[model samples]
Target: MRITAAVLEQIDTQTVPHRITLEQIELDDPRDDEVLVRVISCGVCGTDRGCLHGVEPYPTPGVLGHEAAGVVEAVGRNVTRVHNGDRVMIGFPFCGRCYRCLRGEQRYCEKNRDLTFSGYRLDGSGGMRRRNGEELAGRFFQQSSWATHTVALEQQLARVPDSIELEMAGPYGCSISTGAGTVLNELRPEPGTSLAVFGAGNVGLAAVMAARLTSVEHIIVIDKVPERLALARELGATHTFHASSDTVEEIKELTRHRLDYAIEATNGANLVADAVAALGMRGTCAVVGGSSPSAKVTLKHADLLGHGKRLIGVMGGGGQTPAFLESLMALQGQGRFPLEKLVRFYDFADVNRAIDDSDAGITIKPILRMPA
Candidate 1:
C-alpha cells in the first residue's frame, strides 16, 4: 500500500545537517509473523534525536520512530496475539529465539543491536521502498512508524486498553517504560528507603513518578533545569536539587548518609559518577540513559568493592513488555501514574519542529499526530 512517511536522505553532516522529507512511499504487506499498523501517533524520544544529531547510527532514506500506537489494520497469518482493529502500542523488538528472550528478558536479546538498528529485517530485507524503486530502511526497532503505516513483528505489539488513549501510550514503549522499569523491576527499592534520581528529563521524571508509587520514603531529584526540578517535585519528588558540586553533599544530608538507591537517567557521564558517589553502603545504582555506544565510564574501585555498591545497566526497563506495560497502563488508568502530564502534541507535518522543541528542552515528551 502507498503511505506517507518522513525519510532521512542521509546522516547529518557539519554543513548538510540531518533532514527528513515527507513523501509517498510503498510498504510491503505483512509477513506471516508481522502486522500492518495504521499509525495514529508516535513519540519523538531522545534516541530519535540521538540519531538525528549523528550520535546514533540509523541508515538513511529511512523512517524513524519506535514509540508508536495505532490500530491493527492488517495481520499476517499465524498471528494470534492481536487481530485487525485492535488498539496497540509498539514496543521494542527482540529475537524470540535468543537465550535472554527465552528467559523472559526480551530487552537483553542477544541480537537486539542488529534487530533494532540494522534498518532492515534480520534476513537483510527492508519492508519499505521509495516510489522510485529504491529500498528504504524501514524496520527501525522493527517498526519505522514515523509514517502513516508500518509493518511490525507480532511480538512487538502490546495491546492497549480501550480506556487508555493511544496517543499517550506510545512513550510507554520506550522512554517511560525505561525509567519506570528501572525502578520497579531492577531497583525494587523497599519501603522507607531513600532514593535519588539524577536527571529530570522525561525518563527521570517518569522515575520520580514511579518512585512515588513505591515505599521509598525520600525521593530526591537532581537536575540543572529549575523548571524540570520543580516539575519533578510536583510529580512525587520529596526534594529537588540543582545539579552542581553540592548535589552529592545535599543528598547525603537528606538521606542522613544512607542513600539506599540511586538512578542515573541522563546522557552525561559525570552524573553516573555522581549517582555512584551518592549511594550508601550496598546501595545499587541503575543506569538507564542513552549515551553514545562508544562512551565509557570510569568508577573508583574502592567506592564499588569496599562499599559493596553496584553499578548496573538496564535496557528498555529490563523485563518482558506485556506485564510491565500493562501494569503501567493500569496505573495510569487509576490516576496513580499520570504520565500524560509530560506530553505535548504536534501535527505530523511539524515533525521537525517537535524534534527542535524536544532538543531545546521546550517539550518534555513530544507526540506527533500522523495525518488521518
Candidate 2:
C-alpha cells in the first residue's frame, strides 16, 4: 500500500538542521504474525528528538514514532489478538520467548534493542520501502507509527475501550506508562512517605499524578519551567520547585532529610544527582530519562554505600503492556490521572512544529493527528 510518512532525511548540522519531510512511500503487507493499522494519532517523545539530533542513531529515511494509537485495518492469518475496526495502541516490542518475557517481564525483553532500534525486523526484512525500491527503516518499536499506516506485531497491540478517546491513548505506550509504572510498579512507596520527582515533563508529571493516587504524603515536583511546576501542582503535586543550585537543599529541608523516594525524569539534563542528593537513608531513586546512547552517569561510592541510597533504571515503566495501559486508561477515565491537561494536538503535517514545541518545553505532550 502507498502511504504518507514523515521521513527524517538528515540530522541537524551547522548548515542543514533538523530536516524532516512528508513523502509518499510504499508499505508492505502485514506478515503472518502482524497486523496492519491505520494510525489515528501518535505522540512525540524525547526519544524522537534524540534520534533527530543524532543523540540516538536510526537509519536515514526512517519513520520515528513509537507511541501510537490507531484502528486495526487488517490482520494476518496468524494474528488473533486484534481484528479489523478494533481500536488499539502500539506498545513496546518484545520477544515473547525471552526469559524475562517468560517470567512476565516483557519490558526487559532480550531483543528489545534490535526490535526497537535496529530498523529492520528480527529476520532482517522490514515492511517499508520507497516506490523506487529503496528500503526505509520503518519498524521502529515494531510499529514506526509516524506514517499514516503501519504494520505491528500482534503482541504489541493494546485495545482501548470505547470510553477512551484514541488521541488520549497513544502516550500510554511509552512516556506516560513509563512514569506511572515507575511509581505503581517499581517504587510502590509506602503510606506517609515522601517522593520528589525532578523535571516536570510528561513522565515526571505522570509520576506526580500517580503519586497522588498513592498514600504518599508529599509529592514534590521540580522543574525550571514555572508553568510546568504550576501545572504539576494542579495535577496533585503537594509541592513544586524551580530547579536551581539550592533545589536539592530545599528538597532535603522539605523532607527533613528523610525523603522516601525520588524520580529523575529529565531529557538527559543529568538531574539524577540532584534526585539522589535529596534522598534519605535507604531511599530509592528511579531514573527514567532519555539520553544519548553514549551518555553515562557518575555516582559517589560513599554517598550510595554509606546512606544505603539505591539508584535504579526503569525502561518502558518496568511492567507488562496492554494491562498496564488499560489500568492507566481506567484511571484517566475516572478523572484521576488527568493526562489530558498536558496534551496538545497537532496536525500530522505539523509534526516538525510539534517536535520543536516539545524541545522548547512549550508542550508537555504533543499528539499528532493523522489525516483520514
Per-model TM-score versus the true fold? 0.98, 0.98
Per-candidate local distance difference test: 0.90, 0.91
Give the per-residue lDDT digits (tens) of candidate 2, residues 1-372.
999999888878777787888989999999889999999999998888888888887888788999999999999999987889999999998889989999999999999999988888999998888889889899989889998999999998888877779878999999999999999999999999999999899999989889999999999999999999999999999999899999989998989999999999998897888889899999999989876657777877876999999999999888887788888888888888898999999999999999999999989999999998
Q: List where candidate 1 sits over 4 angstroms from the true fold.
A: none
lDDT of 1 by residue, 1-372 (tens): 999998988877989978888999999999999999999999999888888888888888789999999999999999999999999999999889988999999999999999888899999999999998999999989999999999999998898987778888899989999999999999999988999998888999999999999988999999889889889989999999998999898898888889989988885444788899998899899988777777778889998999999999999888796668878988998899999889999999999999989988899999999997
Candidate of highest lDDT = 2
Tell how far residue 304 is off in model 1, in angstroms. 0.4
Q: Pull out the clashing pairs in model 1.
A: none
